[model samples]
Target: MRHQTYGKLAVLAFALVLVSFVILGFTRAIVGFRTARLLAAPTTLLAASLVCLLFVRGLLAWSGLRPLE
Candidate 1:
């Protein structure tokens, strides 16, 4: 159950990253670099969050705290 939740969260995180890029591209085209840079903050934070989640999941699996089965 926990692993499944993690998997779903990971996918959601990836989707968010993709959406962020689309937003960034649109803003860069319509507004400017400054606005795009400001918008990038959330994307960067989401990327970091995703990395942390993956790292914790890996550690749990490695330590046998959360087995694949």
Candidate 2:
């Protein structure tokens, strides 16, 4: 149960990263380098969050918590 929840949360986090990356890319392209760099903050944050979630999920799986099963 916990593993499943964590898996879902990880997936959500990854989705957020994807969305943020797209937004950052578009903003950077449409705006200038300075503005794009500013927008990168959130995208970077989302990426970090996604990585954390994936790490957590991996730990859980290693502990015998099969979320995908």
Candidate 3:
């Protein structure tokens, strides 16, 4: 099946996952960013990325199911 079959929200969710990874890389590359609060950016991005991935995957899976009602 084509990805479009999953719906637009799924597409947006996947894009968010990609963008999060890109931002995560940039945050990790910054110099002198060891302060506690500044250090949390990458960790937060990772968590957000995981959630987006799970949401997209769940949408795809749900789209493939058929209800008997």
Candidate 4:
């Protein structure tokens, strides 16, 4: 159950990140980056958080550890 929950959460996060990246790219191109810069801080934080999550996932898999166990 925990594994399934984790998988679902990971998938949802991936989808949201993908959508945000697309939107950010389009907005920067059409609406200019000066406006986009207003979004930079939150976006950077999210990106860093995602990267950290990915790193932790990789580390767990490499160590053969089950998060709930």
Candidate 5:
């Protein structure tokens, strides 16, 4: 049950991140902010956060750390 819950939460979090990235990309494109300097920070932060979350979740699973009931 705990593993199932964590898996669901991880999927939800990933979906949210993907949605956010699409929104950010569309906004930047519409606003004509094509330059890397203008759009790098937020994109980088979002990507980093996603990566960190995945890493943490993977580590937890690998180390046999179950989610809270």
Candidate 6:
């Protein structure tokens, strides 16, 4: 049961990151490419995706799922 909290926290963090990614994407769409050009970089979005995925994997571990097994 101790790990459940960490698992939940990880999931919550992942959700937050996901929300931020969406918000950034939305802003990029609305603001146009003339300004805020950095948002257009694929790396920014890719990094967010990677972090979220890592959190998801960690969440699984914290929830007691053996990843390699």
- Top of the candidates by lDDT: 1
Quick one: ranking by TM-score, best first?
Answer: 1, 2, 4, 5, 6, 3
List the candidate 5 regions with Cα displacement exceeding 4 Å: 34-54, 57-61, 64-69
Off by over 4 Å in 4: 40-44, 61-69
Which of 3 and 6 is the better model by TM-score? Answer: 6
**What RMSD, rounded to one decimal, does every model reach?**
2.1, 3.4, 6.3, 3.2, 4.2, 6.2
lDDT of 1 by residue, 1-69 (tens): 366877888888888888788888888998888899688769868877987978787788889888655
Candidate 6, residues 4-66, lDDT tens digits: the string is 665665566566656656756777788975444455445455556766766777778668784
Candidate 1 C-alpha error for residue 20, in Å: 1.2
In order of lDDT, best first, we have 1, 2, 4, 5, 6, 3
Per-residue alpha-carbon lDDT of candidate 2 for residues 13-58, written as tens digits (9 for 90 to 100): 7787777778778988799878876877776787787788678767
Find the 10 residues in a row with the least total lDDT in model 3. Answer: 31-40
Given candidate 6, what's the lDDT at residue 49? Answer: 70
C-alpha lDDT values of all predictions: 0.81, 0.74, 0.57, 0.66, 0.64, 0.61
Model 4 superposed RMSD (Cα): 3.2
- TM-score of model number 1: 0.76
Query: Model 4 over residues 1-69: C-alpha lDDT tens digits?
Result: 256765775676676667667767877987888776555546556766876776687578668784533
Predict model 1's lDDT versus the native.
Answer: 0.81
Assess candidate 6 and give its TM-score to the true structure.
0.43
For 1-69, candidate 5 gives per-residue lDDT tens digits of: 466766776676677666656766776866765553355556556656766776787777678794444
Clash pairs for candidate 2: none
TM-score attained by model 2: 0.62
lDDT of 3 by residue, 1-69 (tens): 344544564555566656655655666677444543365565556657756765667666678663212
